[model samples]
Target: MTTTSTPAPPRIALHRDRLLPAEPATRGIARELYAAVRDLPIVSPHGHVPAQWLADDVPFPDPTALLITPDHYLTRLLHARGVPLADLGVGVADPTSAQSRAAFRLLCRHWPVFRGTPVKLWLEQVLVEVLGVDLVPSDDTADDLYDAIAERVADRGFRPRALYDRFGIDVLATTDDPCDDLAHHAALRDDPGWHGRVVPTFRPDRYLEAGLPGWADRVDALGEAAGVDTGSLAGWVDAMERRRAHFAEHGAVSADHGHRDAVMAPLDAAEGERLYARARAGHATPAEAETLRRGLLFEMARMSADDGLVMTLHPGVSRDHHAPSRERLGTDIGADIPVAAEFTEALRPVLHAFGTHPRFRLVVFTIDETTFSRELAPLAGFYPSLYVGAPWWFLDAPDAMDRYRAAVTETAGFAKTSGFVDDTRAYLSIPARHDASRRADAAYLARLVADHRLTLDEAHETARDLVTTIPREAFRL
Candidate 1:
């Protein structure tokens, strides 16, 4: 059997009206609205791309390392198809090893599995628009596709800072540990040649979770980093305050919370201190740890209220759901599963305490779409401090985004909702994801115009606001 190396690949032209309404009249409105905001500078107020990628300004290694491995969106699907992660370069000692080429080949072979999925759309967009690679990915074209991309990656023009500039990103916020010194963020900001605005966000999940292994060590490390003692709950709070202040001194405007639930029922300070003290001494039980976690969440809200860091909370996902996979490959390899989340009752304790506090800004994200119209939108509708976060993580698909807009608009309207957030670690997908968001919003706004719910002018304005003004305001950028 002979392999056909020069097989004709499908043309990769993107439709001008993709993701817009199918009806001619409404589609025309969506087309105009999308064209207006399609090239708007992306205001990425919430994301997971590392500041170090830009700070180093290094050329990306290869296609697999750049596109496949770091992106759980791609890897999880491939893993589900029984393509071992190792073959996709998941946990290899060297990403440049032979496994990378195999990974790319395997990925191309399995590309059809990504059909009708947002990941496929994003990857195709990246390949066509971002990478400027001409061929569609498949077993027939994998080698040439990989070689062409590898050549581009080897060029200085394809370096992180260069791509950051090319992406037209106005601002990028990265998730950072509270204990992180944010040295890379500072370096990027301070570099005379670099002018991109990259900011840090305070994330203290490990230190706050008392039941987790290495939580004690993380607490001690936070104390060391902040020059404060973590002897008690109050001292730990002090340490957290110092770190938040430090993050602010750099460029942070928000603190991100990722937990199984959004608990804010405050315990007695003394009781909370006792719980922490027991944990510090290795005598804390699981129940005590749960108490400490909730109390710490309450304390965190108070701290946010006091210090004015926008509190962005998301719950209802069981992280690292497959323990065996997580243990073998480490965490965030995308084995997590989403569960139903209760925001109304779960957040009452915190909302009652700080919902009206003028300084506090609470933005809540959820994978559980069930809560949007029923619980989240209504809650955000009333709370001055609460803003409904954009459909994020598992809910960033096109239909999900459309559903999100329809769900939240009735109660919270456009202003009370956090605008599109590209919650991704895949750096190049920033614009593709943002583009998907703009098109989705344009389509939604066009429907409102067609239904006589909003004027066409109003819909256009809302589309622009969703792209720029709303994200800036929600994250307080």
Candidate 2:
């Protein structure tokens, strides 16, 4: 059998009419506001795209792998609508039998399902504005779109580094395991041709608790990586310090934690040491696990203070909804569900210890919108070290973003909040997601200006800060 290369598709044009704002008065305001910050450099302070992709500079495989298979947002929604995961080449399904091209066609066929969805908006923006394909992707145009994208993937311009430059990214951060070698980051820092700033963010969920299935093995690996013994509590702390220093050497500016809830327990040194020993022995009870996790969190916060790494907490997730999937996929396969989170009371201990310190920075994220006005905004408003994180996970859409600003901005103001952070694993959607955020922010500001709440000039300045300045300052980029 023989396969031939496909030809490139014609460029898609984004006219001035496609811009948001339909009202005559607000339309001009929106356009002017967008113009002031549309081309500002993107500072992506938090994300999950690995640095290896940029360091090695490899071409992405295909539409199935790039778009359909890996994107939980795409597959999970499709699965919810009765489309089997196998059809999308997810799980342990056989890709050859599934027909990867047909999966792409099916996604395009069902593209209308995403109509008011953030996925649809991001896809349209990327298709029309970034990828330069004007035609709407549907059953009629699926094959053509797939072939065009595939052809581009084989081109040098579509490589990760090229896309990084074309996207106008000033700095990009990838989330990394505490036990990671970070060799790829070192390679990128040494390469002169690849000048784009790619950094790492420390994520220490695995090492902090022992309830996870493979904690013993993970601890041993951490010990080997950091040149410390894994048998003792003090040694484990030393190993963490070593790994943190390694991450810092590779340009890490922040540390990220995703806890079950915003709970913390302040334990004395002896108690913490005893709990750590029990956890390492795989004999930790539920209460012990919770206490140890919280204790390590406080330790992580203290380590951030000592090392100058900004601490970011993404709490309130109930991971692993499907036990079978958890057994098969391990974790983070779109099964995580959000629950109620308490910011004020749960974080009181940690906040009381470090909130007044000027050098300590803590960014708090939540899935509970109910906490925005009542708790989070108020907490961020008062604490010198606290900043509210951007609308996260399920809340990163246009409506949610606007609601966030409305809920918190009056009380906390713009400075108390961190700017947009695309916490996505899908690499291609980075520019699209950021573009949607920029437009949504501009639209919101336009409304404010039209309402006489803020002047057009002030809105323009605020737009620039939200897109560029705030993220840099908040994450220490």
Candidate 3:
């Protein structure tokens, strides 16, 4: 007779209590504080969740599609660890026809790769809190976790609107292109049964770039969307104005721009008109393209002042860093790479023109961490119209968040910052990311309280600000 081996028991609890303060007195205080604010509603003022998900109210297809396909954060990290993109069902490959189960099993096998990383923490939280799954997912339990998740996702309760309500999200903002018609947004607004507040953010990257190969066609689309002829400089400007008005009618309170650099060049009307003609004719030289883009950015600032839409600029990303990948998959598919950015000098033209103006509000973001104190904080400290955006992209993790506060708070202070924006395409990870941010912030504040630098009362208030007040006020939620 042969004896069978016994499997180890899976960890069932979140372990948050131990992961947080452990000293008896400190633990009691943290538990009490966390209890009071643990259930506060989430305010997501900036993100990339598709509105159609809510409008259509359809169940997500499968484990791979639901969790793996749309999350670039997960895919990029896995790729960094020598995992091929095709194995994760990423790139332009057909995930639906491929062996999704095998791919998901591979991810589950490599779950340990996420240990000590933010992704692991967030996934654990989502699993334990959101799905109520206690068993740790590994190769041993991969099939069980996948089947459970897929089953729950097939239910109507897991649809976008239901999850939005269940998650207690107070406000959600969805980013949209300049040429978008926003029909789904209108549908949501008109639906009496849906009470969730989902708003649109105007992102005009395609329209702003004059050097793109298809700029003329994109301009024509913008004109058609706005019902204005964009053949002339004046007409193109009018088209942009019309589109902004349309976006405002859809409850848009912010306009976002993702550019290669934050440099702003203010051109006189004649110069602007000349550059516009070149761009319209598809004959613009590199210098002319730069001049036109800068001119348009200045005009966008003026429009924001007039329309009361907060302007957010994300710069220094060298888009399509992998040329072959871009040729195969187009933009925003994990090809964007960060570069060193200059804020003080690059933004001088726009700042000098409108930085002190009360009507204008500009929030700037950088992937370069070195500039946080040296450039961003100082600029935000002085410019009334400028505020430093939260640590973005690769810097959204826990340690980076801590470094951001440690570096910027001394100079820019809390008031000069715009709080946090999740900026995610993964809808399920929202709460997890925010939870990590809150914990990291609380830990930082606890240190301040411990060192006598701040009172506990002040730390509590600051925690609330970082979570709720700042995003609401900064994004006009």
Candidate 4:
């Protein structure tokens, strides 16, 4: 068979009214609302970007490394299409020039795989808006686009700190392990030349998971980091508290909890001590470890209530669904899948204790949309300390975001929602992700205005608050 490839577009253009309402009257309102918040400063409370990137201020290595490799959203979809993770530079520490170019070609050739996905939208924005690429991504234009992006990233203007400023980020929070010294965060804060606010979020998931391997050793490490003894359960709690204080001293505003579920029932002190002793001795049964893990989650919430760090909970993920893939490539290779989440009963224990506490603040996130209206909104509707987190993980797409707004807003309303969170490791896509969210919110709010549920002025104010005040209040930024 003889065939000719179609030529790529000369210039890729993004629509100005993208993600807005379809009807003319509603579209007009959405445009206005979107315009009001399109350029607002982003306040990212929860994300996976490393603080070292900003502290070091290094130029991105290459197009594939910067854009393709680090983004699991792109890689996972490509992997589903029978592409090896290595082809996309997933496990390569430093992919060679040839390898990089080859990976870029693979992405371009498979451009159709991303059609109608948020990954496509974010990549488009990153390429055209951020990196100044002209031609659409395709096999024919891969090398040209790669060269263009490479030239741009090589420029000093594209360094991490410079891009942070250009992205108009008011504050960016990075997730960090409990044992992390946060030296990079300290360096960024203490640097006289830097004025940007980059804070660390205390993520103690691994330490709290008593069921995992090396759980006992992780406890020792935490104790060593906190300069405390972990020979007893009291010392373990003391060590965690000390580390939390250390993070707070370095400008942490939130504590992140990611468990298999949202269960937070606390165990009595004697039972907790018994379980801790068994786990520390490597003799605790799986069931005992799980009970201890749930108790640890409650302890974390109790600590948050005492220390004033906003507690952010995102649960119900069956991480590393494919064991062989995890064994070969490692965790977070887009193998983590969401499971059904229950919040009402699961969170009743913690909510009962701290639901009315003045110092406690809780932001709940989920990948299960079923819980939005059925559980999350109703829960946040009553608890003064609770705020419904934005659509997260698998649900961060354009349509999912619109659905999220519709599902939660009826019960909890706009003020009770936690605004948008990018929750990304792809640093360059931050603005694009936030922009997409703003557009989705605008579309949803515009429909309300068109239906006379809200006035245009009220919608405008809501659009502004969604970008600014809501996140600030939710995360106590």
Candidate 5:
């Protein structure tokens, strides 16, 4: 007699209560809190997704490009495990099918490296939840999973804008250089067929870093973009203000800064002009550049006070910490490492100037977790214009997020905390990142409820606000 048997179930499936508390009572409350906001429209006030992708609304080439290549969070880990970035199609404009397939296989074969990581959570979510791939990633399942994802991405309905809608993103913000023409943003805005709200964020980090190579040329480019002559400090300021106006006219709600530190100091006009000349002439010492950058950051806060653009700053990053990696693959390939940050003293000058300014809004972010209670919470508690930014960058993990809520909520309360910011370049992982944040927050709130610190009704209300009202108000959306 021959017997037919059902195939074994897939190796792994996402747990319905993956990040919920282990205790039954807290878990129940968390499940309820999560259900209330699980399907809410995503409000991404800050990210690095390119505007052109949505403007063109093109179908992604393959799973590797869509999932593995563009996400440094994955690529950097793969690179650490003896994989060359080039082999992973890191900078390849159009990777051939074979190349892409190999990269995907490599990722699958090395999936163990991502265990206990948020990358694992996001990948599993994307594979099963987003793309409907049932099989777990492994050496044996790489080809099948790749084929499945490739087929899905090839469909017209899987185009960027379609996915944007499918992701239920109410508002997505893309970071842009000060010299950008924003033509792609204009295209999306003018397209009558599109109804999604995508806004540009003015990121002026490169323009402010006088110590970087080609600072003068970039300043000149910035001036040309704004139709001004940036020959002096005052001229540069005027050019930046005009470009900001242009951004505001095009619906930008925030200005982003990612300097090395959070220092914002004032400079006299004479000293500012002198430092500007030195920087432009390529003769500025490191100290002079530091002074100029800090003064310029102070000016940025001043500009925000005047223009009503929310000033968002994430500092304490030592960008390109690994010189060889940067030289080999250029920057932002996840070599950026966080250093200890001192916000209390560094931000004193800027805070004193704009902390109570009615029009000024500053959201400060850091990867350094130590600042949560010691510095950020107290600052946010006292300053009407300041909001403690969510756990960001490396600290965007579950435990860190729970710690953040515990640390800040005591002093600043929920209202003074900026809602979760994805802060990602991996466009496809946006939903997964936000989902992780939501779950972490729900778990935290459930603990509060279980501990009698908050009622269930209050927890539900706060959960809703975290994903909606908080982000809108924090980013001034």
Candidate 6:
């Protein structure tokens, strides 16, 4: 007797105008607009893509680690639905083929949780568009799908550098610590076989927050890296400046900050030093630590004003909301949460000092959507130094992005907004996420054209700038 196997679900598909307008006339214009910029080389000005990955040019260890675990959006949602991080291969450095296959199956069994989300969209692209997998993930077909992706990932065409070339990335910037040696960046820049651009953006949040754990060690490391003493606040400042110079020399153009609030208060030189001294001695209270943090914000603006590194500030994220999970998994493991942020008053001090400075440039990002029209847009409208960053991270979904365009364009206009930034640690999601933003922008611009607010030619040119020139100019790339 011959037995026939039951076939799996249909192969996945993406609509050519997946995010275009609902109206027929508007969809027509959006289709034209999307076509113009769909193939433009990606310009990623700010992200967490590890420079080491590109420099090493290595094959991905496994499909599960590469596609499922590193993505907080995927892991966090699954965690919310009663999945343990360890079961998904969260802490394992080099998972075995069996363990990796198990995690992939876990993800497949819970696939319904990802329905109608940006994470789903990005994963679909990675599976179908990038890997050419035919199976839609589900419990019935998990093992087969895993084998299919695992086989593709092991091929030479799937190596990091080869994929980078295929992704059409022109400029890819990575977020990094001020104390980092950036040796990987130097390696990529100097490699003859590699032509991809991977630059670093200085991130000094933990080092500035004195009350945070490991501040003392990080401060010492910064001093050692810069060849400056850290016994005094002035020495610390000098060390920071030296590191910033080093970063710029190796092709960095910007610095990034993720403050709990947007406050940038002025401080006297002696007073600032006194607070820092107390912090080093482990005597500063939380209030003192916060004050010192705000004061450093002012100094950071002062330095950027002098050295010309564009400042990208995203404030009001309540990180490590789940204390136990954070303790177990460490930072950026999907435990962070968003909170309301204030701007006008908190930023007045720095804005007044550097708002008109020729060398200073600032791009502000918020997870607080209420402030988009009420605060950020108006501030960007008035200050020459200010621009609104892309709606990303928590707000990278379709509706929030469309709302972002509507909220800011009236006050700041397209010219004063930072172009789309795919801020991900996931290398494979780079083009997929950027494609989402492009489609969203096309739909929004098509509406403007339909409403007679913009001409088709004007919309076409704006689409080009949003993907290419805006990010380049905003980050000074």
* Backbone clashes in model 2, listed as residue pairs: 12-132
- lDDT values for all models: 0.89, 0.84, 0.82, 0.92, 0.92, 0.91
Tens digits of per-residue lDDT for model 4, 318-363: 9989999888888889988999999999999999999999999999
Q: Which of the two, 3 or 5, has more TM-score?
A: 5
On residues 1-477, what C-alpha lDDT tens digit does candidate 6 reach at each position? 999998758778877879899899999999999999999999999998899988987888888988988888899999899999888888667778898999999999998899989999888888889989867788988998888888898998998899899999998999999988899999998999888888899998877899998898889998999999987889888998999999999899999999899999988998999999999999999999999999988888899999999999999899888888777767788887899999999999999999999999999999999999999999999999999999977899999999999999999999899999999988899999999999999999999999999999999999999998888888888
TM-score of each: 0.97, 0.94, 0.94, 0.98, 0.98, 0.98
Model 3 per-residue lDDT at 198: 90
Tens-digit lDDT string for candidate 1 (63-141): 8889988899889999999988777777676865467888999999998999988998899899999889867778988
lDDT of 5 at 56: 92
lDDT for model 5? 0.92
Candidate 2 displacement at residue 314 in angstroms: 0.7
In model 5, the runs with Cα more than 4 Å from the true position are 1-10
What's the lDDT for residue 126 in model 6? 83
Can you list the residue pairs that collide in candidate 1? none
* Window of ten residues with lowest summed lDDT in model 1: 90-99
For each predicted model, how many residue pairs clash, with residues at least 3 apart or on different chains? 0, 1, 0, 0, 0, 0
TM-score of candidate 6 versus the correct structure, residues matched by position: 0.98
lDDT score of residue 177 within candidate 6: 90
Per-model root-mean-square deviation over C-alphas: 2.0, 4.6, 2.1, 2.2, 1.7, 1.4
